[model samples]
Target: MGTCACLRVRGGIRLSRVQHNKGERSTLMKKYLATACALCMGLGVAQASQITVINSEAASFVGVNSNESLGDPSNVVMNWTFTGGFNANNVHISGNLTEVLTGTFASEADIFATLPSGTLDIDQSSTGNYTGTVAVSTDVSIATPVDPAGNVSFEFYESFNDGAGTDQIWDDITIEFQEIGIQNGMVNLGALPSDGSLVTYSGHNVAGGLDFFDFSIGGPGVGAAGSYLNAQTIDPVTGDTIDTEIGLFDSAGVLVAFDDDGQDFALGGLYSMLSFGVDDPLTGSDTTPGADGATLAAGDYTLVVGGYDTNFEDLTIGVSTLADVIAGTSAGDYDLQLSYVPEPASLMLLGFVGMLGLRRRR
Candidate 1:
């Protein structure tokens, strides 16, 4: 009888231990499943928040130099068919023109005296119709002295010398979204690892009217609209400072923000510096505190760098504080560093992930 009772007790203990082990395994599986579901949910939220460019289009504005004293500006109509419904708020339009000297000029002075200038005015309709008027001014400078033999190639920015007797003929014109991003035609800076990554790139504003660079902001910085960017121009060869101006455009090719001198005092020089999505409270200040600036939505963006006052020609060559480089002028080896910002949404996701990890530990 005693032997039988001992046998029964041993069997009961073994059965109890087996049941406890199975219960532990079930609890572990439940916890793992909960964590996995949370991760997937977070990822879904992130993916839904992303905004991307679904369609793009291009058009050319051709100029004809009639036998008249001044050439005529060409009006080009641009059309876009969006596979996905068009977002008027997100639509951006930008263009660039290459100067092709059809015939030789008489003299160098005559080159500037009769320098060709063109205007590309973008008019957008509520129905997504885009009309551009490219009018070349009449050559009033024809009376100016000329050699009629000398020819020169000059680099000028867009919208230079609007009212003067300068006429422009734009060939190979292209209009589209931020198609000028790094891979398309802008300078490439490689992959950006994180926020505050100081990436340096160099390029020249020569025959190409503008220099554009593409950079990405990922991780926790993907959705923060309050992030700001800082760009400063440095001489690549001598490291001597060069006056640089920077503009930020969204993937849609819209000019979101611009800055001329945002970092003068900190660098203690006149080299160009600009901030995007960041506010500059200090009047006449060159540096903008990243915290107090304009807000930029997280996504791909194009950075356009040019000589100071090299963008538009409202100011004169010598009168305005604009850079001296004008049409037919080329600046090379300009260096700049881009400061990045993280998105606010990324931070929230990170926090949620951390919480999941803690729960799993418990």
Candidate 2:
């Protein structure tokens, strides 16, 4: 071959080798990007499918019971269907108190729930915070229950009010629940108050306004005292961790109110508790104040409670789980509100990406 032609051929071989090396590096980069995308997708799916044990419904109740409680239709019922995935096996549903009806006391009431054979814990808080017992049946299902999980049926009942004349009603009730948090369960709820913000009660010159406090289902199996949680602190203005009342609600929209005088929370299920206790005291000692005890759980929800006047109007308090906070399901339209405190890492990540792009342009 001519010398010039042979040199040209050698140059062509060198060029082809360079092209091959470039192609290999490009393929390697594509693989790395694909892996990162898959990882991000996996994390999103985990967060999307995560399960929340407690769910509260709306409140809807009509008349008041004769004994001075809310009233007859005050009884509310909500159903919680479990689909065997939660690692923990226990569950708890609690309600708030609004106003106790007072008059002729023909009967008394409480929350009734049927579970798939596990322990039951009933906590009651009024003027004095108290936790009590629940009534359970002696059925086989109640004895040896199945794992993976099952469903629970619950209802709230209260005494009837017969007006011998002095019939009165109470107000302020709220409801919430406690259950397991799982599937890569290492949840560092971190500084919740920092993320979402707490409402502070200012001066206690008067006994009314927004009270922020939380009740959660936890005692065993859950992460910490704060896990499966709800919490609230007195407004710093008041600065007196002095006792106060709160409200509770259920999916059906039943209201329950808590009282500091009696130290218990009472309200009918199926109605959102409007207000419970009066600035003034009840008249007769024999008169019955309205208080129907109950527990609850159903689906997506929002809870609100406060004094009738405006200064305390803006203060709405309650802690919620993803289940309670996020409305809607894998399907349908729902309103959800998520509050979080800002984190330094998130800000740093954004700044770093912006700087990298600026450097590339230069």
Candidate 3:
């Protein structure tokens, strides 16, 4: 979580749009893309690569975080999948990030909503393990690996440290599950926890936060329509911070989203992963707080990363300030990691360039 926040955005956003074809831009789209692509090339503006799930299985906690445990993969195993006689599985969180990056949103409406779109059904296979079906739709515009969409089997685990005596932080988990074809008879599939490539970055967090600045989905005018940032603080050395959370603040400096532990889907859910989708409400309003799940508008927002002693839920929509959240945590090194999609607008500019070149050659 802290290592990702260590990343720095390149300057402010600068984009140009022609006004003449607000309605007829489709007709002039080719000319614009061709011209824009040439300009971008002349200016040496390189395109940012988007994510393509490279491996069928996510690199193990060791695959990415080999820096800890002296590069001995055996030390950091996924044995923490269970805790205290319960299933501490957080495979659903892996599903969540995968959905967001693929431009999909999963909604779990409160029972009180006027026309509730979601159903409250869990397969709690065992009263003790707490198993249930999560939302994964190949049925919708975006097709998840699952066939019928809502037939995902997820077991919510109260994430806890692996007890290996290695203090560690988890970050940016792109959780994935195996597809078992049909739905009706729900089957338990294994998890392909694709914890995103965990490359460490230096120089993160100002005092207690991993701060950065940038635009939202549609560039300047839009907020981060369906964006999110997930953070978890982990280290092998006990002296280093173990539990680190994150907060997203808009330009207004309000604490929009704050997470202490992640969905607790992985690593005992001790890390934090927060969503900044436009549909999601501000934290403190939902003030339910912490690893439970929180949302904020995705845009040019500030990120606060720090360590705390225990789970604190004081970060309310109207009441919690930046200091209020970070003040509670112990002073520790913030390890940050972030996973982001490409700027669509930039992709458009470059994408057209490829098509045009192919046409010219033909």
Candidate 4:
């Protein structure tokens, strides 16, 4: 390791230490935000993540989910870097898998049934520190009635059917998921706007399944007073879109809000929309009616955008949505839009102006 006195962005900016004129305080809030947002652009918006080497019978690679919310069907590169040396020379190491298993999770300790998986048997008489990686999406999701909150829910255990040699002394084996930081399960979408503007996140089910994003209600740009969000499935080239569904979850990972056939569109209700403080009860969660006007408060929430038929549920029907998509039911590219809609006051003002205009014309 080496050390140098380089410009340091130690965590974040300390405004108190760099004091400006007291008179500039009024403009400081807005100005500081402008500068801060710019800094955020450079610092990045991924969640904090940490990886620990496991000695489970499951000797496969374990990765940190960091900024990825549950249901995101993106391929993650799992890297394994070992610091300890193995005992042997002229040692060659290689491994492969029998097959691949995948799953999306809302929690840990999945109750859904899965085919039995065996451990990857790796036997190597290698020389120095070793590093390896495997591109795996997911294995299975652990859920409620199984694991507690904040516990990472899924693991990728690719079994190696080669030799049986576990003599690698691995004290620090690091595995990374997209090089993103992992916080206490909070996802920070890179494109989410911090300046209170309409921001849209475009996603494709590259794997053609369900996708998810986690954010906070009263956190930063999204104030605790609540939020407005919508999702639309698109066939960009064709211009003809399909039905899209959305589900909302609280910090506890409970399915508190879900919408099917929501979102007022000129074409129809093929899109999805939810307003925490504005939208009527009927316009919000079909599974949880109380979710309407319920997003006001400082807390975390996760949004799930899935195929037209995918719901917030378990696999009573087989790997649940995963299998359904394979059978060709729910899967596609979609857009999730988050922004603050017009408030009641603004609407009333516009209505008042309209009435005044009519009277003048008469």
TM-score of each: 0.37, 0.21, 0.32, 0.36
lDDT of 4 by residue, 179-207 (tens): 11112212344333332343344444322
Top-TM-score candidate index: 1
Alpha-carbon lDDT of model 4 = 0.37
Q: How high a TM-score does candidate 3 get?
A: 0.32
Error of 4 at 271 (Å): 2.3
Q: How far is candidate 2 from the true structure (C-alpha RMSD, Å)?
A: 27.9
Top candidate when judged by lDDT against the true structure: 1
Please identify model 4 stretches exceeding 4 Å from their true place.
1-187, 190-196, 206-208, 219-242, 267-269, 279-291, 313-328, 341-362
lDDT of each: 0.39, 0.28, 0.31, 0.37
lDDT for 1 in candidate 2 is 15
Clashes of 4: 17
Alpha carbon lDDT at 30, candidate 3: 46
